[model samples]
Target: MKLNVYADKMSQPSRAVVFFCKVNGIDYEEIKVHIPKGQHLTPEFEGILFFFLFDEAINLMQKLPAIADGRFKLFESHAILIYLACAFPGVADHWYPADVFKRSKIHSVLDWHHSNLRRGAAPYVFNTTIAPILGRPLNPQAAAEAEIILSSSLSKLESFWLKGNGRFLLGGNQPSIADLSLVCELMQLEVLDEKDRTRLLGPHKKVQQWIENTRNATNPHFDEVHRVIMLAKERQQHQRLKAAKNEGGSNMKKPLVSRM
Candidate 1:
């Protein structure tokens, strides 16, 4: 199976895919899609999107239908994750537990991720961390609202999700899908300002340690992952600053920059 990933190295979902691929020692060609350049909106992307209109990760999903002529198109990072876990069962047991109760527990974590953590936390990361770098600070009210939600969500994860000592989520055992989602989300939080850092990752020792552990999972690749994630965030921040300058020069109404 040829796995062609169209991803911006800086995107969290893309980073998750990269993390998954590295963990599995999977050989694949990574096609960089420059989100900052708006390459995702290009004609080629439009064509790919048209093929898989229902799926945001169209470029990768569309290939399955074309190559095998089966119901192969897939979308959503979570869905792709489940499919990969089932398809490559031997690679890593952490993503999909074999035990029935463990699997159910993992599903619960994923469901929680979709409804709570992802919903609450992602907007803050996007608005403050990415959008500012993209020439726009988020709307004042929206950013404030997102930060509130993110704080509460972070608190919940630290207080409840990390209750055990198994090295990751799932009640003190090895990492499961829950841990993966949490790790990816935490990666976004690492780019935040002091207040957010304190509100999100500061008090969460487990989450903090998990981040450190994932960084050095494999000798050679550990440093690579750290380098890639940090570089991506820095580049995005720089771009946002440049965009902010351009926006100011253009006299666009700027949202008052404030940290909650």
Candidate 2:
């Protein structure tokens, strides 16, 4: 069965799915949920009638039995990743393990994703960036407080989770879903201004090193994920340079006027 993923460009969950598929050589088709265009909110894309039941899209998946059968199928990311790893043996060893304890450890990462990381980080970043662009201004104080909380959590993750005595998150051999989930979340830090990136990710040398390593690695895809990130970063820098030039030009005019 071809895995179908519904995602927006900047979404961390979506990126994790894409990264996993690419790294594992899993075949899938993507259905874009372009939040900027208000596409995710549409009946065609977001409607429970059209797709699987996720926590965010649970109501929509209620009607489709073929898609909603809890037996012989799983919709949650952790469940799906485990299912995929077991089904595709040649994929990789680091993702999920046959060992019961090792497998349970991997599942814990997913559980943490829903409760801690998503709760702490996702909303703060979304409200800070996407909300305003979508015409909703979340309270500034709430956003700031959320960032601090999220950053603190990130610091702990750096010290303990991502840096957990392995070359990757699962252990020293390679990476697993745990690594992907953490990396995907770290990718969101790139959206912040320079100061925020330094404050949030810079102090975590291991986390920063892993991210740099992944960006340098290869993935089999028509469009690789990090390539898109690099292009976006370059574009943002260009815009900043243009704005600086205009400000400089205005300052030059003021000096000339004063001389006159």
Candidate 3:
């Protein structure tokens, strides 16, 4: 049985998992779980649709980027990326690498990502932009707090993981799952208004270069997986403009027009 990757492109981790699969040429089917529509709340049991109703089922997964490889079921994007790198035959070595020491370092980076960087990046984007789209009021105080953490996290990456002479994280010439995951997380900031986005990301020069390098390494596949977020950004911008015209200069959170 081919691998089935259930994911929502809008999700940061989900995009990383999907992009990893696509970049490595893993044979898999993408099962989209559209979160904005609440599809994740009622996921269909793939390959066994009628085995049990979604309401009655006790063990059915309820998350983006869950996967079923034959009988093996897995969630969590980092685990999925590592699994694909090790499970697939044609995956490049630099992704996870064979050296235990190097792999351990990669693990360290991933650990740090969730503990530190993600704490700020995810919520900052959520409170600042995604909140209004979800019919929730924007939380400037929370966004402000998250920005401080996000900026600090970027500085750590610059001084530590990205300190060496190489382009990628830990001074490596190639991209790894850590790089992919972290970069994808940062992509959430793309939806921010230009001034805010620049203010947060501009000062980290090494981090900026590393993002570009990883992006180029993954290329078409990287951008392909990220198309949804970019689309969301475009739609939000258009909505703002139309809202301005229609509302006659009222500065309020206009509803995010559904262009997905």
Q: Which residue pairs clash in candidate 2? A: 48-60, 166-171, 166-172, 167-172
Best-matching candidate per TM-score = 3
Candidate with maximal lDDT: 3
Ranking by lDDT: 3, 1, 2
Could you tell me the lDDT of residue 181 within candidate 3? 96
Please say which candidate is ahead in lDDT: 2 or 3.
3
- Which consecutive 10 residues in model 1 have the weakest lDDT in total? 62-71
**RMSD in angstroms, candidate 1?**
8.0
| Reference-based lDDT, each prediction | 0.64, 0.63, 0.84
Models 1 onward score TM values of 0.75, 0.77, 0.87
Model 1, position 200: C-alpha lDDT score? 61
lDDT for each residue of candidate 1 in 1-260, tens digit (9 for 90 to 100):
56655566556566566566677776655666677766676777656655644444455432211111123645456666666677664667756877798888778877888777777677877776667557776675776788787777777777777666656676644555556556776677656654666766677676677666555554355445546667765776677689889988899766798887
Model 2 off-target regions past 4 Å? 46-74, 163-165, 216-223, 242-260
Local accuracy of candidate 2 as per-residue lDDT tens digits, 1-260:
56655555466666676777777777766655666666655676556423454444532432211112332433555555666677766777767877789878778777876776667677776665546656888667877777777877777667766665556665545667777766776676565556766876767788777765555453443137655555655665676689899998887744335544
- Kindly state the number of residue pairs that clash in model 1: 3
lDDT of 1: 0.64
Name the runs in model 1 displaced over 4 angstroms: 48-71, 216-223, 232-260
